[model samples]
Target chain A: MKTPTIRDVAQRAKVSLKTVSRVINNEPSVRANTRERVQRAIETLGYLPDLSARSLRSATSYALGVVYDNPNAYYVISVQNGVLSACREQGFGLQIHPCDSSSPRLAEELRDLVRRSRLAGLVVAPPMSERMELVRYLAANKIPFVRILSAAEDPADGYPCVYVDDRDAAYEITEHLIQLGHQRIGFLWGGVSHRSSPERFKGYESALKDYGIPLDKKLVIPGDYSFDDGFRGARRLFALRDRPTAIFGSNDEIAAGVLAAAKSCGIDVPYELSIAGFEDSPFSKQSWPALTTAKQNTEEIARHAALRLIAELRPPGDAIAAAYAKNEGFSPQLVIRDSTARARLPAAD
Target chain B: MKTPTIRDVAQRAKVSLKTVSRVINNEPSVRANTRERVQRAIETLGYLPDLSARSLRSATSYALGVVYDNPNAYYVISVQNGVLSACREQGFGLQIHPCDSSSPRLAEELRDLVRRSRLAGLVVAPPMSERMELVRYLAANKIPFVRILSAAEDPADGYPCVYVDDRDAAYEITEHLIQLGHQRIGFLWGGVSHRSSPERFKGYESALKDYGIPLDKKLVIPGDYSFDDGFRGARRLFALRDRPTAIFGSNDEIAAGVLAAAKSCGIDVPYELSIAGFEDSPFSKQSWPALTTAKQNTEEIARHAALRLIAELRPPGDAIAAAYAKNEGFSPQLVIRDSTARARLPAAD
Candidate 1:
């Protein structure tokens, strides 16, 4: 028989992890009927609330450390808001720390933060998620953690995670351009170390291959994730004798940067050149024509991940098992805006 | 003789309130030398190291509740960071609750947060700084607090505070603009009811007066501290038949927003218009031409505030008094960047 966790209980309860936490804390104002149903589910599932470690005595908390790098203001703000909401529901406080994802100091910082707080668990946001040392540190420390994917991890077992399906999203976006009758598409690659960069590239390639389009290696450009980098990357693409008809920048900042570069070079958006970006942020709306981008639901991801960590702090109840069995992966929703259109590919008949 | 509090001892010992707590409880790890110093300080100041109401504690810690409602990312981030840093150093936990600055729920939410966590203190940010009900409620309830200014207050018997000199900073900035040959300068205003808005406007007015320039009510525009407001404020100023030669925005977001609007209108920057902003934020650099603004040193302010709050938790000593007197007020540093230039009036001789 598969052992149950509190997360399973949350899933079965049809409530957020925070909601379950409130119930466990015996906090008031919960709808009486709903509480009764949750209680019934709990009794039926045979869930046992676990408190094996001194952590219970120290503090009965569902605390999780959220660490991030790649300081896109919108991304950080969204993630913070999501984590805050989840923490509120769980009766937990998130310990936020910003670290250089690639720095050797990362492991040290995580260790200090965890040891100092005696954390219940963790949630790692890229580019820290892709670093092996981070993964190894979390594993070695025996801390349950979920990593937001910059790339897809195999089998997703080390610690259960909620991830953005970047690959599919990227592929669909690229396909949208192709379907719009664009032949040559320019790719803006984020920093190579981020696993999502390659995954997104793969998605683009797969879509092209599926459509019987020959890949042009020259059109793929690499740059760090920033407005300046985006601007520069687009500039390189534009300077080419055979410029791509449309561009796919890594993220919104890069897309904006690309837009600025194009405008300065006498190119109009969506008319002379179409562009698309990832991670629909405030920047997307603020952009000149508004950006057509993928909405990653960073807040939802943070909330769910926090919910998972908090829920797992409880002992396995049968209801939790039932709940866990219901929801496994959450698919992202696409948001359409004005930044993209059918590419005006010269090759179009 | 004046009675002392544990904050006094902590300040004198150059340790945390938690450390003072440990010393009072005779918990381990305090050096013999430091312990003796604390003892001597306690004796000299006749301070009580213990709060009998709180000292008889249970398993849970005394949490600090923070209520805020400003969207200036840097400001929000800094405030949280400061509170977190203090909480960590004090060995106490903080629960953050976001409340509307203008909502009646502000007091209710704060009271609820306090009741739920059994909070020991609060750090109120702007918007709430001027809320009389909030101040009265906390006073009536005997909740200790520190208010980051939205307005100046009567200093006598006021709670220990950490505040920004908005009027002074604003005055200095406007004076700088004046020195660089600007008249008919624009003054962007912040939201109504925030005491700082009028205070900042006063500084701009005073600076113009000092230079013998007439206060043109036409140049003062009202908006919130938002990017969109910045854009609109600039538009309102530019739409005038005789637009100001230089613009001083309320905050960095507004400044950046206005900067963006200027670019959209195809106005030659610095050549045709001079722009200056307050709050030297990351957004300033992110702007196209960068921004010359005031560096309020959020980190230092937060660090000092946290340290001050902790300092107030221990028994007082002569050394502690010396330390407190040394750190009364911090001046905001004027961070001049790429955003401002000497103004050339519309019809210059």
Candidate 2:
């Protein structure tokens, strides 16, 4: 079958070619009823408007790319969904690019992608967003993009970003445990490359210092953000002659591993040991006894990042653009579940 | 910074306009040395070839869309990764579209998307792929597409699809349990809309019939593909006076829930009760006792679907197209883990 054309749409709608064109371009000259008829006719005939012609006239590509290098499937999906929602609302197309952040040619690859795709802008996700050098490269190249990064405050480098305060959230989580009488707490670190890991560690340290509890070097274990890492880290802690009362997993996956490890060792969670996780993911709720963690609104953060990028592309003074111009920041709030409780006093010596 | 044009690339490579064009078009007439020089210059200058001009001359859009309506983040991410890999190899841009299959205007929405985006083709994921009405509409409209679905055998409706043999895989799983000397086994169903649920149910029933065990209607609990549902269903089964010694969750998420439930109920898995799950997702291994499941190569299946779609878009008699012309089918293989074991003979009453 031959592809349907704008002329076919015009003929089917019983309107002139110019009127159909006006409706396709979203020109306000067309009456509402006429525009509806044209849209119905277009859908019925499945008429494809010439994108090349439209792009040339507008001098802008109606699409954006989202670049990320993350292993967490849930986080990636949430980011995609958020960006998709923004694109859908604005009548723009979205392209998801999952890349290896460790690649030496990362900048070159991104430049090539931006040039070849003719993308209007980009939403760069962490840990790529945390790399100041890459961010500077993008800025120097005049590539329009927004960064979603973990930071206590803006870097003040003139680069637009949506930041999450992992340090503050971590501090709050630690404080919660401290209040629950957990003096000797074990901390499991996330991936080192991500700025969030260090930021969270700092928060944990500050809380310990404030509580006048000596931070134990042995209690802090280095591991990536994964279930296996959490399990291994927990096992290491469990093997110690004097184990901590509470274990804090940087993320939910890690915490879940800790829970599984505790179970394997016949240690009752919240009774014999307390396990806490970050990121209130779906499984966090489904886990037996549930997990107490921080509720980071990843989808919302990603949505704001895309919106900020789009705002930069739009003309200044545009209503939506102006609304999104201000940089956004988020602080994950602690969600108390059954994972944590008062630390039991040591058995009578 | 000024956007570099093709002329700039040609000048940098010390080549004429025609030579640069040939290199950009990937014509065989261009020498390898010349192509390499042109490519390096293009990358260094960050030149963007006029996609509209190239698309117009060739009459092809270098973009495709992957449409899905799945709740599983892992499954969705795998599909996206697979499609992205194919698109990367084929020099095509990919758009990810997550839509509601239950929408009444799903067909109209898809038609508008295809028309507006001018996509070369679409990779449709289930349960949208399972809807014959929508599939027929695309076929009738001459919209190029490939579907990924679950079936015992190809429907052979002429429409190209990649089918997973859920029935066969389920049959193997059930047989494994029956061989373990389990007479009364509980079954959990996935979403009713997805054909896999019924297909898997049929396989389970056949396995029971073959083993000369009567189907206990009360033992089969109707539930969707979710951890909550699995937990609820398991709780109900445990409440029964005559509880089954073995349980088969339709998918890994369900099985995970069952594992959690068993822990809550103080039931010893694979000792007093046995559990098995389908789909070897990451969590299955992370679960306390690793699950025995059917390993479905979702990424591979999705990749084949995209390759087949791209093949359809390529010119006839093309070598790559020829390789992907044949319809693909898959049977998930059973993976034995700690979740299952020989059921001990019931204690003498």
Candidate 3:
């Protein structure tokens, strides 16, 4: 059987080629009665508009490219779902491209994707946010992109980004612990270079200062976001001469790892050592005692970012001012679970 | 600047468009000198074919569709890796489309994808596996697909498939525990309706018979391959007055849940009771006493299925047979980890 075409639709509808085009493009001048005929013809003929072929007819294709490198399944999946939902509503399709710096021809490869895909917009993820050369290349090429998490402190000057107040979430979490009388806290930070780490650390520091507790540098250790790193870093926390009574891990995987490490070492959780994590991932819930963490609302944030990208690419029929009026910057919510507990006071000698 | 075309290459090479195309397609009988000239012209013009656009012209698209229903991260990720690797090797782009029974207009939706995406082939995963109606629909439509674990008994009867020999693996594992001195054994079962479940149960039953241990109906409990099921099922095991010293869980998540359930109940693992699991997932290795489970080689199987799909889709010019010969079936390897232990003697009367 032959593939159905626009020609087939035109013939089946008993309409001229131009009339069929008008019906497909939803040109307002077409009579409602005639439009229904064309639609019926499309249904009967099972004629799917060759999306890419149709794009070739348009000056700009209705497609956006998403280039990501994040390893967190929940975060990535949420973002993909959000983007797909937005794309579906907008009559567009997303081209999801996952790349790692390990691709030998990384620069050339991304550039090739940009050119070949003929993408109207891009959704960039870390650590591509830190790839200045790639960013500059995209900018130079006049490509519009929305950065999910820019390593830059202030893309404020130029680049548009959907961001979280990581520092604020960290501060709130710390304060929550402080209220529970936890002073000797062990902070496990994500890599020192990422912008979120320093900001989160600052939040932890500020909470301690506000509570009039002297900050101890020895208690703060850098931890990569991996679960193994969590285990190793938590072990270091336990090795301290004045070991922390409470531990805060950078992410859920790390937090779970910390819990596992504590379990292996015979440390009672939320009793001898309270623990907490960030990014309320599936891992957080799956872990024993569950993790007290921050809810980033990743899906919602991703939807907002995708919507913003689509709006930037092709202005919707609605007014930009009205859309802006409805737009609100989001904040990460704190999810308190069983991981954290009241400070265990020293037993009487 | 400007986009380069095949016309630009022909113009640069001072040759006919046909001659340039012959070099591009690597057709036989192109003079070496002419081929070199064409290659040089192409390089100078920077003429990389726009695959989406070209597919419309030649009707040979570099796109494959991945259709699956399950939301399990481990399974999805493994399948994605396999499909993507195969697609990349064939210079194709992959579109991952997840579906379920509840998705309204299933046939129409799939047909719509087939029509719009210009897919060369497809990879389907369960519980979409059990949807024989959809399977027949796809076959009737003349679309090529590789079903992942669809047929338990006959793999090649309907279409090409990559199947796991879970029954055999389950048998050996159960037998291993028996050899370790366990008389009474517990079995945790997943959804019985699944095609794989009955086979796994058969292996367990037959293995026990060979070892002369009477099958204890009281010790077996129904579970799903999930954390909650494991937690609930293990509690039932704990409640039994004459509980088995060793328990076998259906999968890793259930195993983890069993471990968690034990920890919360103050029961020591492997010391007082032993537990085993199937599917050596990342969670298995990361679990407290890493799961002693069957290594499904999910990644390899996925790669194999994908390779098969691509081989089957190979064009007249391509060496389809050789490509298939390169990748045959891969068996699941048994990984003995920390989850299982020697069965302890029952408590003295």
**Best model number under lDDT:** 2
lDDT digits (tens) for residues A1-349 of candidate 3: 6778889989988888888888888888999999999999988888888867877667677777777766666677777777777777777777778778456577667767766766778877666755677777777767877767622233563666677777888888898888888889889988654567777788788999999989998998887877898899999989989989888887787788889899889998877888888888776776677789988787777777777777676555655323532323556778998889888777610
Could you tell me which 10 consecutive residues in candidate 2 chain A have the lowest summed lDDT?
A50-59
Give me the runs in candidate 2 sitting further than 4 Å from their true place. Answer: A1-52, B7-19, B28-48
DockQ of every model listed?
0.10, 0.57, 0.55
Q: Per-residue lDDT tens digits of candidate 2, residues B128-215?
A: 9999999999988788999999998987889999999999999999999999999989999999989899999999999999999999
Give the CAPRI class of candidate 2: medium
What is the C-alpha lDDT profile of model 1 across A21-104, one tens digit per residue?
667667897898878767766666655443222243444444567888756656776677787787777566566766677676
Clashes of each: 22, 0, 0
Docking quality (DockQ) of candidate 2: 0.57
lDDT of 1 by residue, B1-349 (tens): 2335678778887887787777777889999988888888777765553222242254333456666787665677777777877776666656566667778767766765554445667877777866767788877776666777733333444667776777888888999888888887898898876777888888888888888999988998888877798899899999999888789998887887777788778775666777888888766755556678888787667656656655565457745334643224556777777668877654673
Q: Is candidate 2 or candidate 3 better by lDDT?
A: 2
Q: Give me the TM-scores for chain A across all models, comma-separated.
A: 0.79, 0.92, 0.92
Q: Per lDDT, what order, best first?
A: 2, 3, 1
DockQ of 3: 0.55
The stretch of ten residues in a row with the least summed lDDT in candidate 1 chain B is: B50-59
Q: Which ranges of candidate 3 are over 4 A from the true structure? A: A102-105, A150-154, A316-328, B102-104, B150-154, B192-194, B315-317, B325-328
| lDDT (tens digit, per residue) of candidate 3 on B113-149 | 8778677778776656556777788888877777667
CAPRI quality band, candidate 3: medium
